[model samples]
Target: MREHLEGVRLGGEMEEPRIRRAAPYRRIAELREDEEWVKVMGVVVEKKDSEIVLDDGSGLLTVFSDKEGMFEEIGVGSQIRVFGRPMLSVGKEMKAEIVQKVDGLDFELYWKVMEEVKRLEEEIR
Candidate 1:
């Protein structure tokens, strides 16, 4: 028998699903306006009090967060990955939800792998 979540209330309603969709990994230049979630890997070229400028070779993008401790371990020249929601109202930027350091990623190899993954996904569709 499976457990039921009928009594569960999300924001006083029981309609919310328990799963979150995965954010797609994308290069800075390929991000689309319609995408709700996105993941990007880049070098932290510049970091401020609330934002960091990331360069993924394809382009430069600003990733910001108002939440505390989000940029604690991040520093200039640090290679990191950011998962966030894009905010295109002003310029090329995103409201970061998660930021993680990537210690030894080889961008050349990573790019090749992503290209192959995209090709496979296209074939499946």
Candidate 2:
């Protein structure tokens, strides 16, 4: 039993360090953009059958995702960080093709904003 517990502890210690090291790359990707791609951090504001929209304070941008399930699970006002490439729609609207959804915020302000968005959505429904 003692040996087994030591093995479990060692496994957890090793895994925790790896997860921590990988986190910076994820956050860096959220704020860096290049000529062909843009990284953004914001809240999910709207979602439709084919697109998801995010409001990043600078502006509202639509994101197209082929995986509908991944898109559907994200709720409005949920703080998210996304990395994607920008493209122009036929009508000249800008859009992003999302590659990832980073973790959400956990502060009191974030919770309050999420609540307000949920209430507004309920009203619209």
Candidate 3:
């Protein structure tokens, strides 16, 4: 029993949530239901104490932070990347576990490569 408990503790410590790269807000808004551990990047359009709104040109969505001080430096017009599980109420909302400030994201180049990658993957399939 003692050995079993130690193994369980070690397993719990080693199992961490997989944080994935954020998708465009357009994709998020189109989701039919809850998705696990999603991330999104956008400009901060609105902010309160624990919640913030981001618009990535595709759409605007709200991300809520559970950590009190996580949003301290976040403000309007700041670009950020946020990770959470997004769910829809009246609209799409996310309870974010991680929020990161970002700069110099080459969106144009990134999208172009994404398009090419998709095309290749489709052809292979």
Candidate 1 structure quality by residue, lDDT tens digits, 1-125: 12576776567556767676898899999887788899999999998989999999999999999898788899999999999988777888999999999968998899899999999999999
lDDT of 3 by residue, 15-125 (tens): 678776655333444544546666677889999999998887667888887788988988898888887777776687888888999867775565577668767878999
Q: Rate the local accuracy (lDDT) of all candidates.
A: 0.90, 0.54, 0.75
* lDDT, model 1: 0.90
| The best candidate in terms of lDDT | 1
Clashing pairs in 3: 22-39
Q: Which residue runs of candidate 1 sit more than 4 Å off their true CA positions?
A: 1-18
TM-score of each: 0.84, 0.46, 0.69
State the lDDT of candidate 2 residue by residue for 1-125, as single tens digits: 78767746443444344221111111222333333444556667887776777765546667666665656666777776555555543321224445455554553465467558757878999
Clash count for candidate 3 is 1
Please give the range of 10 consecutive residues that has the lowest summed lDDT in model 3: 24-33
| Ranking of predictions according to TM-score | 1, 3, 2
